[model samples]
Every structure is written in C-alpha cells, then in structure tokens.
Target: MPEPTARVEPDEIRRWLSERAAYYLERPVEELDPGAPLAELGLDSVYALTLCGDVEDRYGLVLEPSAAWDHPTLDALTAHLLAALERG
Candidate 1:
C-alpha cells in the first residue's frame, strides 16, 4: 500500500475529486459542479467503487463502499474526506 500524501485542504480534495469524477464521466473538470450530485453527473456504482479505491490509495483511508452515495456531491465528499483525514 502507498503512504498517504501530506495533509490536504478541502479545496484541494474538492479539486482532485472534480478531476476524478470528470475522468469517470469522460468530461472536462470545468463541466463539473461541486454542489451537483455525482450520480446525476453519470458516476455510476462502478465508478464510485473505483473512486473509493482511489481515495483509499491516495489518502490511505478505509472507506465504506457507499461513501459516494452517502456524500453524493463533490463538496460533501470533500468535506467527509477532510474530516476523515483530520481524525487520523
């Protein structure tokens, strides 16, 4: 397993998440809205799972599979991730 990166700010997480979601959606990051539901932007379950894996690998986090469903948006997800990191 890879070591976690340095502590990251919420905006950084949000930007990273937007880029990842954009990649999964096959769109530009600029097209993504932080407040918009990722599912509505076409991030299906498979992508969500992949995203969870990415988060785990990047942040060394053990997240529930339903994390994306629970957070639902880039902003919400970023906040959750930031909180998780801070708790560590």
Candidate 2:
C-alpha cells in the first residue's frame, strides 16, 4: 500500500488549498485568484464535496460537507481552516 501523506501545517494549508483548486479547475496556480469565490471557478458540487473530504482527512478536522460553499474563496477557506485547527 502507498504511504499516507503527512498532515499539512496550519500555515501551509492556504498554499495547499490553492494548489488543489488549481488542479480541479485545470488552471495554473498563478492563474488562480485566491480572493475570488471558488464557486466561480470550474468546480462543481461533486468536486467541492471531494475537496471537503480531502480537507477533513488531510487536516484531521471535523468539517461540514458544505465547507467549500461556506468558505467561498480560497483565502476564506484558508482562514476558516486555520481557525478551526487553532480551536482544536
């Protein structure tokens, strides 16, 4: 079996999110606008849910399935994630 990936550090979560978004959106990382809403990107509900699941597992957080919609932008999501981790 493949080794599990290491947990992401709080500070690095933003960058990781950005990269993931870029991947799902099929755009280059530099082409992404961190401030723009993720819904405006090419992401559908399915991808958003998948991303939420990944986030929960990667960060060991108990996040809602609608986390992507609730956070909206990459920056917003990053801040929310950091706060969640801090609270834990």
Candidate 3:
C-alpha cells in the first residue's frame, strides 16, 4: 500500500514564514517550529520591521509596525494574513 500524503495550504503562507524565519535566524526551514514565537527565534527590531514590510508587499495591505509582535507565531501570522487577504 502507498502512504498517504499531507494536505497543504495553497497560499503557502506557512512555507513563506518558515523560509523567511529560517533565513533570518540562519537555519533551515525544516528546523523551524510553526507554533513557536518568532521573537524567541532571535527576531530583532530590524528583522521585525523588514518582515512587516515583506508581509505588506506580499499582501498589498497596510499593516501596523507592531504586527510582528501581534502575530508572534507562524500559525498566528499566517491565519491573520489569510483572513486579511480573504477580506480583499
């Protein structure tokens, strides 16, 4: 019998976050924890600000500067992005 495959999100927001976080933290995406706080991953002010810009550019939305803090986890950030994107 063949093994089952896992379902994936089409937007790939989670994948984007994982890759971005990994790049920022100097690690591989596979080593990142989706539910882990980005701050705990060594995300500093510069990283946070750049990430906010990245999100805004990617979604074409106006977001607050503190958005990274508001959505600390990859899951939380992705959920918020999905909701915002759906609204537009």
Candidate 4:
C-alpha cells in the first residue's frame, strides 16, 4: 500500500484565511496575515461565528465554541483546523 497524501498546504490555508478575511473586512486578501489580530480587523463575535461556520462548511470540520478564544491568530487557528481535519 502507498502512504496517504496530504491535501492541505500552508499556502492553501493562508489563502483560505486570506479569502475569508477579505470577505469579513471588505479588503483584498493580500492585506491579511496569520499575525493579524481579529479585533484590529474589526472582527466581532458575529464575525467569528460566521467565520467558524464558513470553516466548518468549507472544510467539513466542526470547531468547538472555545476554539475562537483558544486560537485567536490565523496560524494558530489554521493549525487547529488542520488537526481537526486530520482527526476526521
């Protein structure tokens, strides 16, 4: 048997976040980053819920409610999201 391949990549995760950020901020995706603070981008609880919904719908992964508070950064959230995907 062959080893399984990973479908996700760092750039893809970055792009996903970038696209979502653009949708949330009404700006270009290039302006977003893993280090960008959600508050600095004007993302509130409503936006967070929307983002979590998007992640779950798009990636087929469910994020716990606490995930928003636990993984505030894009990189951290991406890591958690990828881990959840891998688990499933």
Q: Note each model's CA RMSD in angstroms.
A: 2.0, 4.0, 7.6, 4.0
**Collision count of model 1:** 0
Residue pairs of candidate 2 with colliding backbone atoms: none
Ranking by lDDT: 1, 2, 3, 4
Error of 4 at 34 (Å): 1.8
The candidate maximizing TM-score is: 1
Cα displacement (angstroms), candidate 2, residue 77, comes to 0.4
**lDDT digits (tens) for residues 1-88 of candidate 1:** 3235467878888998999999989999999999999889999999999999999888888889999999999999999999998878
- lDDT string for model 4 (1-88, tens) is 1112456766677678668867888887777766876667676778788888888777766677667668887777888777766666
lDDT of 1 at 59: 83
lDDT string, candidate 3, 32-88, tens digits: 888889888788879888888887676575678788889988888888877776666
Report, for every candidate in turn, its global Cα lDDT versus the true structure: 0.90, 0.80, 0.77, 0.72
For model 4, the superposed segments whose C-alpha errors exceed 4 Å read: 1-6
Lowest-scoring 10 consecutive residues by lDDT in candidate 2? 1-10
* Number of the candidate with higher lDDT, 3 or 4: 3
Candidate with the larger lDDT of 1 and 2: 1
Q: Top model by lDDT, which number?
A: 1
Q: Best to worst by TM-score, what's the order?
A: 1, 2, 3, 4
Per-residue error for 38 in candidate 3, Å, reads 0.8
